[model samples]
Target: MQTAVLSSRSLRIALPLAAALTLVACAPMSTMYSQDSLPDAVKVPAGNKVVLQTVGVGEILYECRAKKDMPGQFEWTFVGPDAVLKDRSGMQVGRYYGPPATWESSDGSKVTGAQVAVAPAGTGNIPHQLVKANPATGMGAMTQTTYIQRVATKSGVAPADRCDMGSAGAKQKVGYQADYIFWKAS
Candidate 1:
C-alpha cells in the first residue's frame, strides 16, 4: 500500500480555494442578475456587493376605498405590502413593506427602494424589476442596501373578483412570490 501526502505549498493554496468554493455553493443564490441587461437608470453602480438574496413571500394588500371621481363608489386601491422575506433555504430573514418598498434584515438593517425599471412578464403575471435604494437608514445588515432587483416572480395580482370592489373599507389579500436581491455599495 502507498500513502500520498499533499505538499505544504499545495495544501496552503488548496485549502482556502476549497473553502471559498464550498461557501459559494452553500450560498444558494441562483441566476444572479448582471448590469448589462438592466436599464441604465436602474443598474447598480459598479463595485457594489451583493449582500443578500431572498424570496419575498407575502401579499400585495388592497383595500376597497373611495374612488372620488364617481359620485358614490369605491375601488380596490393598492395598500402597501405584507410579506416575510426568506432565504434560499426557506429560513425567514426579514420583512418588506411601504410607500417605497423597504427590505429590512433580521439584524435591523433596512433600505427603502423605488421601482426604476421593469421587464414585462407573461399575461396574468407581474413584471420583474430593478429598484434603486435610498441612502442607508441604519447601521446594520440592511442599511447598506443600495439596489434591489425582484425576479422570478410566481404570482402577485389579486383575482378580478366580482365582489363589489366598491365596498368601502373592504380589504383583499393575494399571495405573491419573488426573488429580492439586495446590493450594497462596497
Candidate 2:
C-alpha cells in the first residue's frame, strides 16, 4: 500500500514535468537569431548604395542599402534599444524587400508592406521613428518606424503636382520623414 502511494505521487510529479519538457522541446525558437548565425561579411552587389548611420540613445549604427539590381527593393539593418517599429497608420513596421514578416503596434494596429519607400540621394530627411526600450538583457531594445510623405513638386518642364508615395505610389515624388520615440522598459 505504501509503495502504491509513493508511486502515484511520483507519477503525478513526473508526468507534468515530462509534459512541460516535451512542450518546450516542440516550441518554435525565437525569431531573433544570434549574430554568429549570420555571415561575417555581407557582400554588396554592384549598383547599390549603402548608407550607415547611428540613431537612438545607444547610438546604434545600422547599415542599410537601396539596390537597383532588384528593381524596387530596400534593406536595412540596425541594433539599438528594444523598440516596437510602427507606421503613421499604427501598423507594425517591416523591411521593404526582405522577408514576408509583419508586426503589430502596441495599439494593436496591423502594419503592412505597402507603407515603405526609398528616396534618391538628395531627397529630404527620410522620416523615421524609433521607440527605445531595454529588455532584461543589457542590450537596448529599439523599434523603428519609417514612412515617406507625399509631396507635390513643380518641375520646369511639367507644371504639375508630383506626389511621392511609398511602394504604393511609384510615380510620385513626395517627401518623407523619420520620427523616433524612446521608452525605458521597467
Candidate 3:
C-alpha cells in the first residue's frame, strides 16, 4: 500500500514536470527585436542627406537640411531610450533632465544634418522569448525582453533660398536604416 502511494505521488509529479518540459521546448522563439525588411533607398527619403550609422536594432541613420537664408545654426537635442539628451556627434550630451526635445536651424551657410536612434529591443513588429533549461533536471522556462537604447534627431540649412522653417524643403527627404539584434546583457 505504501509503495502504491509513493508510485502515485511520483507519477503525479513526473507527469506535470514532463508536460512543463515539453511545453517549454515547444514554446516559440521571442521576437523582441529583429531586422528591418525595408531597403536603404526606401528607408531614406529622396533628398535628405546621410549621416552616422549604428550596428543594432532600431538604429536610425539619416540627414536633414534647412531652408535658404536661414539665420541661426542648426541646434537640436535628442532623447535616447534612457530619456537623455544626445549630441549630434553621437555622444551622450547631457543627463536626463525631462522629456527630451531638440531645436535646429540654419546658420547662414548651407549645411546638412543626420541622426540615428537605437530602438529598444522588443519594439519590433514581432515579439520574442528566451528559453532557459536545466540539464540536470530537464526542466525549462522562457522569458521575453527588449534591447533597444536611444533616440536621435538632426537639422541643417535648407537647400533653397527663401527661409521656410515649417517646410520640409523642396522635395528634400531623409534616409534611415534600422538594424536589429539580440544583444546579450553585459
Candidate 4:
C-alpha cells in the first residue's frame, strides 16, 4: 500500500500506531537492577571485578526454633538455602547455601559472602543484597571471588503461622529465584 494513496482516516490511525511502536522498540528492558543502579556497599571494595553471573533456583528453608535469651518464645530461623545455580544458558553449574551463603561450583571452586547491603525488591519479594567475601576461599573458576550481589529474588519466605513455639522444629521449604553475581578481588 503506497503511503500517498492512504485515506485520511487510515493515515490518522497508522501514524500514531507507528509512532507508538517505534517508541516501544527503543525503550530499555526493565530488570531488578542494572550494574550502575545495583546497591553498593563499602564492604565490597570497588577494586574487585565480576567473576560469574548465575541464576539460582531453589528453596529458602526455615525451622521454628526457641528464640535465644527469650525463654518460652520462638521464632523462625533460617536453615540455609538449597539451590541449583545455572549459567545464562540455564545449564545447572553449581550450588547456593550456608549461614555464609556460599556458591560452590562443579569444579570444586567456591566463594563465601557476608552480606553488606540490602535493597527492597517490592512488597512480599525478597530484598536484593551486596556481600563481601571472606578472605581466600576460592579455587579453580572461583579463584578470586571477593564480592557478590544477589538480586531479582522471587518467592522464598515461609508462612507466618509456622513461626510459633507450637511449630518449633517444624520445617518449611519455599521456592525462589535470584541472580548471583560473583566478583574477584583486585
Tens-digit lDDT track for model 4 on 28-128?
Answer: 32323247655554224667766677899988988989999999998878788989998766667789887667788878887776777888776766788
lDDT of each: 0.76, 0.30, 0.28, 0.75
- lDDT for position 176 in model 3: 23
For 58-165, candidate 2 gives per-residue lDDT tens digits of 122233334448655544333222223444343444321122223333333322233233222222332222211112212122232232121221111111332222
Top candidate by lDDT: 1
lDDT over C-alpha atoms for residue 71 of model 2: 58
Summarize candidate 1's per-residue lDDT along 1-186 as a digit string, tens digits. Answer: 123345766788999999998787677566465657544554566888787889999888877776768756656777777789998878788899875677887887778876888886556666778888887676876775778988777877655764354466777887888888888777
Candidates 2 and 4: which is better by TM-score? Answer: 4
Clashing pairs in 1: 109-142, 110-142
Q: Per-residue lDDT of 99-137 in model 3, one digit per residue for the tens?
A: 221111111111111233322223322112121211211
- By TM-score, the best candidate is 4
| lDDT order of candidates, top first | 1, 4, 2, 3
In candidate 4, clashing pairs total 0
Tell me the TM-score of each prediction against the true structure.
0.70, 0.22, 0.20, 0.73
Candidate 1 lDDT: 0.76
How do these models rank on TM-score, best leading?
4, 1, 2, 3
Query: Clashing residue pairs, candidate 4?
Result: none
| Model 2 score (lDDT) | 0.30
